[model samples]
Target: MKTYIHNFIAYKELLKELVQRDIRIKYRRSFLGMLWSVLNPLGMMIIMTLVFSHVFRAGIDNFPVYLMCGQVIFNFFNEATTMAMQSILGNAPLIRKVYLPKYLFPMSKVCSCFVNLLTSCIALALVVVVTRTPLTWKLVLFVFPILYVFLFSLGIGILLSAVVVTFRDLQHLYGVIITGLTYLTPIFYPIEILPGWVKTLVEMNPLTSFVEMFRDAVLYGVVPGMELHIRCIAACVVALVLGIWSFIKQQDTFILKV
Candidate 1:
């Protein structure tokens, strides 16, 4: 762990360049650039709000805010892990010639998506202002959930980056998993509408804890309970420990594989 930390500090500048490269690649040839980050989730929120709030009648107050909260958290996880999964393969040429820590590649991807996450939160703030939702001191506590989700995503990204190098088929499999995960997460609808068993399953999802904690802070103006803090911390710890362990164990073989 000390060695890892030392290497990370030593190569911090390389990480910065990798993160900048990702942000540039993401916006390359795009007319709107970073504005799309703000607009994409906002647009999705508007469409879903129309369908669920009007058509299906989700019956939730400030549904746009509620929906955007989930989008901001879940979308970051999706983007971070997807990009990180490709980090090793995508930078194969560099990895071959360089002696830098392989973990930096996926770490940079997560950092880049974090920039997008912040911009998406701007969109969420706009919806809150437009909808006249009351802002409370609890809104400041939104940082806690964001931090929790960031760590969780980073751990998952690191784990996937290592595993995907060995099992290239995981790239395709993960897409299907992500699609299923989206519906399993209560983004557009309330959990109350689901049956008891389904509710328990949904609640079991780690993302559910992150999403609900975010909503409690930003949308509902409530500090997340102790249970949420415990769950989020546990998830973060387990993911990071497993991810780092796997990466360290397999990194020496990455050059041959990639």
Candidate 2:
């Protein structure tokens, strides 16, 4: 791990350049450019508010903020992992040309999306202020869940980057899976609305904890309890371990596949 960290630090400049290139390409030829990051989620929040707020509003006070919280975090993971899945094939030339850490491609993609996620947080902050959601000390610890989501996303990203190099269909299949996950995730609705049996299934999802953690800190204005902290940490550790293992094992042949 120390050697890996040292190698990453040695190539930090290359990683930065890759991340910047990603951000530029994402916004290239667009007039609004990066502003779309903030607006896209805000626009979705407005649509969701108008459509579903009437149904779930009673249970979730500040429904827009609640909705935005789930949307931003889930979208971050989705975008990051999606990009990471394509990172290897997308940069086949770079991989072929020189010696570079193969994992850096996926890591750079995840980091770039993280930057976009941070920009989208402007919309969340606006919603919070506009709705007058209570500001509390718990909000200061909001970084905990964000860190968990990043680690989880990074783990999944590494795993997918390795897998997708060989199984190109995974890219398409993942799109469908992400669509299903969005609805199944209880993003716009509170889990309490579900019956006990169904609620258990939803709660079992690792992403659910991240979304719920966000609600707890930002909307509910309470510190996340030990259960949430433990769950997030466990999820992060498990995913990261699996991701690193998978990536290391498969990356040996990624050049041939890509």
Tell me, by lDDT, which candidate is best.
1
Error of 2 at 211 (Å): 0.8
Q: What's every prediction's RMSD, in angstroms? A: 1.0, 1.0
Per-residue lDDT tens digits of candidate 2, residues 43-142? 9999999999999888988899999999988999999999999999999987888889899999999999999988998989999998898898888777
Model 2 lDDT, full chain set:
0.92
Q: For residue 73, give model 2's deviation from the true position in Å.
A: 0.7
* Model 1: number of backbone collisions: 0
Model 2 misplaced regions, further than 4 Å: none
Residue 187 shift from truth in candidate 1, angstroms: 0.6
Cα lDDT for residue 67, candidate 2? 96
Writing each residue's lDDT as its tens digit, candidate 1 over 129-222 gives: 9999999999999999899999999999999999999999999999999998898898888888899999999998899999999999998898
Q: Report the CA-based lDDT of candidate 1 relative to the real structure.
A: 0.93
